[model samples]
Target chain A: MTTAKRDTYTPETLLTVAVRIFNERGYDGTSMEHLSRAAGISKSSIYHHVAGKEELLRRAVSRALDALFAILDEPDAGRGRAVERVEYVTRRTVGVLMAELPYVTLLLRVRGNTTTERWALERRREFDQRVADLLKAAAAEGDLRADVDTRLATRLLFGMVNSLVEWYRPQPGGGYEGEQVAEAVVRMAFDGLRSGG
Target chain B: MTTAKRDTYTPETLLTVAVRIFNERGYDGTSMEHLSRAAGISKSSIYHHVAGKEELLRRAVSRALDALFAILDEPDAGRGRAVERVEYVTRRTVGVLMAELPYVTLLLRVRGNTTTERWALERRREFDQRVADLLKAAAAEGDLRADVDTRLATRLLFGMVNSLVEWYRPQPGGGYEGEQVAEAVVRMAFDGLRSGG
Candidate 1:
């Protein structure tokens, strides 16, 4: 990318461009040239922003992990009944996923090949375990169904939630929203198909 | 891979090793050196077996696609009631996934970077549409609930099922077999968390 004298590129803006390119071209398939082209800067300018492509991966996954863990710190997530806490986290997760779509998409697609991917995988497991603990608490409190295993339920729930990254597209002109999707998810997951009426 | 006079690798056996490496290192991240090391052969010998990495990917996804489409031809899947056929397809899919775990795992991970990956993606959509049509048929028969969108249910069901590849490990000695797991999946997808009793 050709650089202009006026506005300097910070690591953050450069990273945003890098992550989008990483997603478009699978991370392994992307190169310094691709990032330079996508960022509208030279290869040297790209290196000046971040050390390399791996650094860009590290920064993107860090953003996703931070947002996910932050959900556990919210008041509703920490103080509610176990079932309610699960629901709250579920809703907030959908929001975080949409708000930080590129980062989370990168995090999800990681194959644990590099240092960044392995770290991302570990943090992702921690996030899943936190939700599993919430499910365990719900089960113990007699709120959730007793038949399905808690760990199984947690995986199934997150499987459904994470699947959103596969199909969810933001609306133009402010049409569709993640909140409505999250609410439907909670209802279908908690209540099941038998009609809770 | 220097082809020695005694080179004895078949396409099928070479494919097995190649697909495993592909899944572990990812299709794009893996190189000829990695494949040669994994197969315990020379880089040239690798080509004697399969054309290239993309060809291996095509072969693997073909195995997965064949197994999945074969489910549609089964008498139970083709001739039964819509709800029954849906359950049959779900059961058979779980079986196919377990039986062809590595292939389908690779198939699911394809991101459309190459012609083979794009082909896999198109076939995946076709499979999803077939299942969605089953859901539509069931809804038309007034057996399944109509409040929820059939397409949405199809996505969720496959989301949970496809997720098995991410985490499910079969017992090395003896435990639940494919049929039992398929039964549980069908049960969970249809009757759901409610007491089916």
Candidate 2:
């Protein structure tokens, strides 16, 4: 690679390339050599930025996990009735998934084959549990349907949110914004898809 | 291998073993040798059952697609109010996912790396479109909410239904039966998660 390109490569830039390759090829299927080739930098240059491929995986998922965990710390997520708080977190989560699509995609697909992946899985479950607790609190307040299990409801709600990674490509001309999609998710999820409620 | 084990290895049995391996180690990571080792059969024996690894993948995904597409032809799916038909299809789709978990899991995870995977993805899109049409018909009947886009609603609806593949394992004592989960899915999808709706 040219000195110009090599000089410009940073950990964040390298991570963007690495996560793309990881997502294209499964994490276990990718190699450091592949990352170097994709990033247009030497393996040594990659090592200079980080320890190895696992480090990159860790950084990428950590970015996603950090963003997700940060949502719980937001003022809206913290305040209001439990039902309102659940709605706020749900809407904010759709926004996070859309904003950090690639990183979160990689985070979601980890199969726990390695230490980094296992850690990512644990963090993901922790996030799920936090949300599940919110649903439980809502249920206790008589806002959530008592007929449905809160744990199951939590799974289905986030399931719909997480599936965006499978099909939610950003529009070319800003046709559908993240807020609009988030609104659609909240509406269908909370208000039901059928009309005449 | 024992003569008894070799004698009992039907094509159906072999597909079961192959799908397990493919899901554990992704389809790309699996080999005929891996299949042979996992199945307690020789490479020649595996070849005797199917032409190659891709053939096994094709068979596995075709089973899932066939089961899913068959839902549309059901009397319940075809003959009811548009809203009720959507609910029937949703509930039956959940039952199919639960009944055929491993096969559908493999189908959902295909990344189109091979021709078989590409074909599987195309059929998946077709299935999604069929369901979207059902949602559109329901909207025209004024049974679905007008505030949300029908196409987006269809995606979110099935997105919740399909997410079961990620986490809906059959309980050891039949704790969560297929029909029960289907009921839960239909109720949550059609009847709003919030209470007093």
Candidate 3:
């Protein structure tokens, strides 16, 4: 393995590399050796920064979960009418997913085979339920359409948002900004796709 | 492993078990031994049904890809106006997703670690592009809103459709059938979530 540059290897930096590998090889398929090889550092050196692979998985998922849960606490998320609050959460959640793309990608792919994954899945459900409550309230307040089920609506809305991880790639020369993507998402989710209907 | 139920194994039956394990352990992490253990059959029996693990992956993804591609050839998809055709594809795509849930779910999660995965990814891209073409045509006809980018809208639309694999569990007692889920998806995607404009 190429171990030429070894001056800067913090937990965060190591995490950036680890998350990429985790997404590529998968969390279960990845190992310390893979990390060491990819990081260009010895396994012992990697151990100095974090406990082991599970810690890396935990940290990566925690970062994603923290960002997602934090959106619920934002001022707009908390202060708005239920419908607006749902929109706010939807937009901000897109922002978080784009900003923390790799970490969140890893987060979404967890299959709950391990304790950490189970915890992540549970926390994810909690987040979904919290957002579902906003949708439910919005429906009750006559803000949202009455025809669609609130629970199903909530999943589909976030499904659109969460689907960002699959195809979104940040443009290098400022082609598509996060706010622009967020705007499109909010518009499409709220407005029917048909024009001038 | 318990090998009690060996009399009723078919390629289709074995695929159901293998896909579940593939989803749980992931494609790269899972091995023939895992399949054997999960299916309560020897590795030899698994080989008899399918060539190996990659064959199973190919079969599962082919089932999904076939269903998706078949949507493009439907009379509504080809004959209707672009906007209606888009809606037609969207509604039918959701049905295909629900009908072939596990197969499509496995298809979506492949990460291109192996040749089979790379092929699956390429085929998936082809499917996405075909749907995207319909979206572009709809936008050209001024049916879809002009504000949102057509490509982004396509992704978001299918994003909603694809997200079905995450949380949709079929109800046993005639609750929330596939058609109901498909209807809700079409409504949510086309109509703005907010009450009447």
Candidate 4:
């Protein structure tokens, strides 16, 4: 399908282009012109796929948020012992983030300048609170350390997880491998670097 | 020095307002007009203290970079076992981040959009590399866990440090201080939340 036929761009493909441009130019720095240029289409052509820039942002963050929130719903995440649930959420989160790298990367970088961004941030906080609750439960169950504040521990745990977007690049060779990295993160986080003899 | 005398804002005072705006609206989001409103001064008044927005950013990030780079020069940071030095830098880096929150926040948020920002990012990478070296040394000393890559550890460690900008608000009651937070960060980093036992 070329100009001869019909090569209609979907909201999904447009979003892929938009997130990359947003990451490259930043959400605020990007303009319709930038999106048009990156997408190989005219500015007017973009309105066909999505409402505007904000819609693209909303879609991108929504993907990331859904991926994150869905972690809470997973069987392993929901039915495990509190500590196991926390670890399951942690592992799947790193996997989700890596799988949905571009979308999650955009979500992590939002600054709450617009309604979409603020909504995204609120959802992020909600997600954090859910994790914090798990941590709290784990501590109460005596599965996790009671010495640390659950809130602080949750933040540091996600802090390590979310930092992946900053520097993690998927291998150019196929297969989308991530579990190895996730395993390392879990071990480094829960078990500490000190090897027990 | 009464109200009768002409009132003017010093560069230091102007920066406090400017950095807040920068952190909120982003360096690129801010305009001379935004600064004027935030500082309760005319747009022209801002020019008197600094050249323009980029100059303001350069000054702010320079201050932050200076503090971090100086950590490498400290006796405690430079001396002792590699693991100790790594811990020393982590604790002091947290303190530096908290003490110079606005400046460090500005530095962390800068993208390579302008010359000032690119320069700041380069310098930041250098600082990161220096810390990464400390992690490498600690790993070589067989102190750090061998399983996780030192580079990944360095990124996660700094990620823990840099995330302070996102949520840490200094207390109005002054009971919770930066040093206390820094201590907590160090404790959590070296020893797992599970405890020394």
List lDDT for all candidates, in order.
0.82, 0.89, 0.88, 0.82
lDDT of 2 by residue, B83-130 (tens): 899889898889889889999999998989899999999999999898
Q: Which is the better candidate, 2 or 4, if ranked by TM-score? A: 2
Clashes of 4: 0
Residue-wise C-alpha lDDT for candidate 1, range B70-177, written one tens digit per residue: 999888998867988988898999999999999999999898989989999999999999999998988888767556677677777888789888877788777556
Kept native contacts, as fractions per model, are: 0.19, 0.75, 0.83, 0.29
True contacts kept of 2: 0.75
Task: Score residue A161 of candidate 3 by CA lDDT.
Answer: 90
Docking class of 2: medium
**Steric clash pairs (candidate 3):** A190-B192, A192-B190, A192-B192
* Top-TM-score candidate index: 2
The list of candidate 3 runs beyond 4 A from truth reads A4-8, A113-115, B4-8, B40-49, B113-115
Please compute DockQ, using alpha carbons, for every candidate against the native two-chain complex.
Answer: 0.28, 0.75, 0.72, 0.34
Pairs with steric clashes in candidate 1 = A1-A40, A1-A41, A1-A42, B1-B42, B1-B43, B1-B44, B1-B45
Q: At residue A36, give the lDDT of candidate 4.
A: 82
Fnat value of model 4:
0.29
For candidate 1, what is the DockQ-based docking class?
A: acceptable
- TM-score of every model versus the real structure: 0.83, 0.94, 0.89, 0.86
Candidate 4 wrongly placed segments (more than 4 Å): A1-7, A25-37, A42-45, A111-116, A173-177, B1-7, B40-45, B174-177, B195-197
DockQ of 4: 0.34
- Cα deviation of B173, candidate 1, in Å: 4.0
Model 3 chain A: ten consecutive residues of lowest lDDT: A1-10
Q: In candidate 2 chain B, what residue range of length 10 has the lowest lDDT sum? A: B1-10
Model 3 lDDT tens row, B1-197 = 48546547999988999999999877877899999999888889888888899999999999999999999998999987898888899999999998898999999988898899999999998988888898889888888877868877888888999999988877789657888889888878887788886
